[model samples]
Target: MIKFDKVTKRYPGGHEALRSVTFEIAKGELVYITGHSGAGKSTLLKLIAAIERPTTGTVLLNNQNIGTLRRAALPYIRRNFGMIFQDHKLLYDRSAFDNVALPLAIDGVAGREAGKRVRAALDKVGLLNREKAMPIALSGGEQQRLAIARAIVSRPAVLVADEPTGNLDSNYAHDIMALFRSFNEVGVTVLVATHDAGNAEGRLLHLDHGALTEGVPA
Candidate 1:
């Protein structure tokens, strides 16, 4: 569902984040991108999400060239992706329910329907009871779970997570990975960028010095 053809992203200062990275991720496949810091993992994800345009080559999503997408079309392209971050990125002042509902609200989903979807997402992340609680009130694991809920609330076709388990303990990390596995089983294309090698399973893509290396089997 996503393909990168000779993709290279160079910053204004001539720092290339990705160099001729070519890969194709089929629909419903779960993949992990692993590398040390500065390996260009985040840049790869941003390219797919259209947050950063490739300096050279093309990025295709569902057969559409994203690199050439106009600014007005970016939001439509991004709606297909749900992104999670290591920082949680939750609105600390909003309730967990509201946080999860933000995407739906942006998409113009009605109150009753958004509530149903928000509650379902919270339940999937095992945070149903904390819907009214602020982000600061939750534990680290719970906060991460909340982020997961928010990401999946819109039922995105692809899920992109960057260092999702970075801030959590081993148990929490395991739980988070398991949650991702469950979503993949349900046919959501998942691409996770993590430095934690232990989480490298399924199809593994490695990066080194901005270049794409060989992929490892599960």
Candidate 2:
């Protein structure tokens, strides 16, 4: 349940990343946002995640306008969605379990419950045995799965992935897509921004110059 209405994002230098973009995603739907580099895919995800405020119009999550959320209340809004990035964004000093537990820890979840959920999430990504492994010790695919575990451990209503398969080989990339599909089937709304056409096999939405292409359902 995410909606972008006439949204436009312009940087301080007056470079427009998105122009009058409008879209809506219903609950439990898995959609892909795809385009070439510099095509505003990341900009759109950032706006939805509230990492960047729009220059104009609205971004709504479950009927709440994210653009209107106060800075102090932003974390509460963010708690409703999970996000993954191209880099995996793992902590070099932390173990896989620690990384997956970060979100719950931030929300003040105590030891036992956090541990339970963290273990479940890592297992979902097939990394339960690697819980004690540092990010550097894991392969590229394993690190990416760990990142996925971290994102979904909180059980957020929506999952936003920005090039989650960017660094991996084709096999690993397909594995990541299958993981997303499995998550979506279990009822999480999945919005993925990708450049790989192979990943666009299901429910594709193409974007260009910050605008979604025709026939692309949000």
Question: lDDT of each structure?
Answer: 0.90, 0.88
- Model 2: per-residue Cα lDDT over 1-218, one tens digit each: 78888899999998888988888888998888889988899998888887888889999887888788889888888887798987888999989999999999998886899999999999999999999999999999999999999999999999999998888889899889999999999999998989876636556667788777743443
| Backbone steric clashes in candidate 1, count | 0
> lDDT score of model 2?
0.88
Worst 10 residues of 2 by lDDT: 196-205
lDDT of 1 by residue, 1-218 (tens): 89898999999999999999999999999999988989999999999988888999999998999878888999988889999976879998899999999999888997788999999999999999999999999998999899999899999999999989888888888988999999999999999998876745688889998998867222
TM-score of each: 0.96, 0.95
Note the residue pairs that clash in candidate 1. Answer: none
User: Runs in model 1 with CA error above 4 Å?
Assistant: 216-218
TM-score of 2: 0.95
Which whole-number lDDT from 0 to 100 does residue 48 have in model 2? 82
| C-alpha RMSD for every candidate | 1.8, 1.5
